[model samples]
Target: MAGKGFGRWTVHGDGRGLAPGAVVAPDERLSWPATIGIGAQHVVAMFGATFLVPLLTGFPPATTLFFSAIGTVLFLIITAGRVPSYLGSSFALIAPITAATASDGMSSALGGVVAVGALLAIVGLVVHFAGARWIDIVMPPIVTGAIVALIGLNLAPTAWTNVQAAPFTALVTIAAIVLITVLFRGILGRLSILLGVLVGYATAWIRDEVDTSKIGEAAWFGLPEFTTPTFEPALLGLFLPVVLVLVAENVGHVKSVSAMTGQNLDDVTGRALFADGLSTVLAGAGGGSGTTTYAENIGVMAATRVYSTAAYLVAAVVAFALSMSPKFGEVIATIPTGVLGGAATVLYGMIGTLGVRIWVQNRVDFSDPVNLNTAAIAIVIGIANYTWVIGETRFEGIALGSAAAIIIYHVMRQIARARGTSQEAASPASAPAGTELNRGEPQH
Candidate 1:
């Protein structure tokens, strides 16, 4: 029999041998050798997006790496190492970073981002004190499912954009991932994405698509560039609203992990928020792009079925180590756009499917107009990619959809209750003949 080994978690099984069908959950772990290797894969999974933000925003790559490492460590300590998330540069801040960098310089924009972390921490404090009851009241099964699904769908364009760059290579990569994921069992299946990317890189090399020139020229080791966040009151106007977007992203990310691992992380929501906020704040202060939980790593978890927080730490360690090597970063840059694109296609789609699976597993009642309307509206808003700007704040599609799903669902639920409609009642048109096949099972 096993008891709690670390903090609040009950360590299942002897830590020596992993039994068949014994899931390696966030709290549980494999052997150290296996863990470090898996952690490296997680780094591979998060690499494309983590590095892309700095590359695009003119932020120093070293800061991204260094802060990301420290951020992960901080998050692990804050969440009691229960959440298996990788903190990386958030693309959500790209717009604000770009605008601020143009006018007030990079340091000022970064100062504003540090302020964002403080705001998020306050929000986290509120969530922590309020408890899950009210939060769940607002973000019930249907609403959470829609929000999670929106995240996956929202990235569909990015996947397509990369694939368009090298169609054949991307196609080859996709096929490799699908074949490996479907055909192989055990660790091979777990590493399918890594193998797919590798195969795609080879294909790219054959086609002369990968640039080989940078590998030799890059330094073996160098300090990552860092910027000090200069206190700028004005920058707050630009990035404050992005907090809502970050919250939406984080909520969906946590829910997705819960759905995948059959673990209820509701209790850790406050800590998670606090961890991400502190990470962003730390990253900003250190002159790195604001860090957030990465979907790419989440997708890797879904695909690999490994949720070891230790493994995530390994990834963080690997990323931090590699940050010192410009050559390593350069090598990563050569991994053909097509390869990353193809992986994105499968990974992103899998996230969307996971959302659908959540709805199915929870047995969300589609016959209920509340459920139907939320799902319908959320999907459209997610795919539409619309943005609204007001007084320097911008609400993108996912942010708007996340808000809409919560607001519209609860608002309608209130109206229905006022009109004396029972919460259990289904629409006559959607559930004919007293059948409720569309309804999901009650969650444990």
Candidate 2:
């Protein structure tokens, strides 16, 4: 039913419990109580990273949350709930936003965001009509895997920075997550990230790492500060490259969810992109950070094995409510860096692993030097946080790595095929198990 995609979620089983090895599908939900708990878990999973983008870029955190929640709802509707994702403040926009704000002010930076969003929405429309086949031709399993893996690995330093702030607290959080997964059964075990953060937060509080002073001064209810965008053609260069990163992120998100849920979500890729673009446009029009599909929430879904979009809807509503109350947002913002570091320690690594899982599932033939080198170069570039600057425009790790993966894969493959050396020189018998060298046109 169309309603299933909108409001009416079919209860998974009796809506009480998930049987062993069974997942709650996108259109299905557990009981209201269980679904709400899962939904809140998704919010917790997203909160640290989502808010951090705005906090770092000097955007209002509550305002970012407000648009993030709205973006998520738009994504659900646009995709007809087939894709489970949360539109959080995208880290890829950070450099450009900072530069734009520094030179042209916050409103000018927002104008850059609106420009990117509009462009992305246009790309989404193209993909929706033309189909995602070009994506496969351009970004085969090897390239896709490289992009996905590098994205997570690229954030390793950010996690380390937080760990350095409070090593002991970070360690405790990590240990809590590890133990929770094995020590408990069912939902308790699945919610290790949420529970681990709580454990970490308690530890931080006891160790005097948390400050409650701001919470008391915050209002119980109020609107987040909003600002209108003003377009500057000069800033467009800084923001345009971001569309490439957002495209990679959105596509990787669809691929990741498809792999995890055993569902083919390629058909919804355009809708996903359009939804996020629309969300970002809304954010830029008001005062909020530009949005992208979040990998942190992907980590949560992997751990919980629940792909229900219903939970995402619940999470969006909860986030929207929290955005309306400064006190609530402040309380959440008080989550110590150490706790985030610890959770990120687990979540970030999981994201990298998902990319590898993509390779494994697709049987990517790394024996082909083209495939091997693509992953090799891109992953290193991303993990090392490579940067290239062109005047005011900057292409960071994710952008550089994503571009390198596509360029390297196609250029190398085309050259190799022209020379009739598509297969590696090594003996076929020496190829790794479950991998085969393709001598003909590559098939995704």
Which prediction has the highest lDDT against the true structure? 2
**On residues 190-279, what C-alpha lDDT tens digit does candidate 2 reach at each position?**
778889999999999999999889999999999989999999998899998899999999999988887777666777888888999999
TM-score of 1: 0.91
Which residue pairs show backbone clashes in model 1? 62-224, 363-440, 363-441, 364-440
Quickly count the clashes in candidate 1.
Answer: 4
Query: lDDT tens digits, residues 356-398, model 1?
Result: 8667766678888878898999878988877888866677888
**TM per candidate:** 0.91, 0.94
- Cα-based RMSD of the predictions, in order? 4.7, 4.4
lDDT of 1 at 188: 68
Question: Global CA lDDT of candidate 1, please?
Answer: 0.79
lDDT of 2 at 34: 81
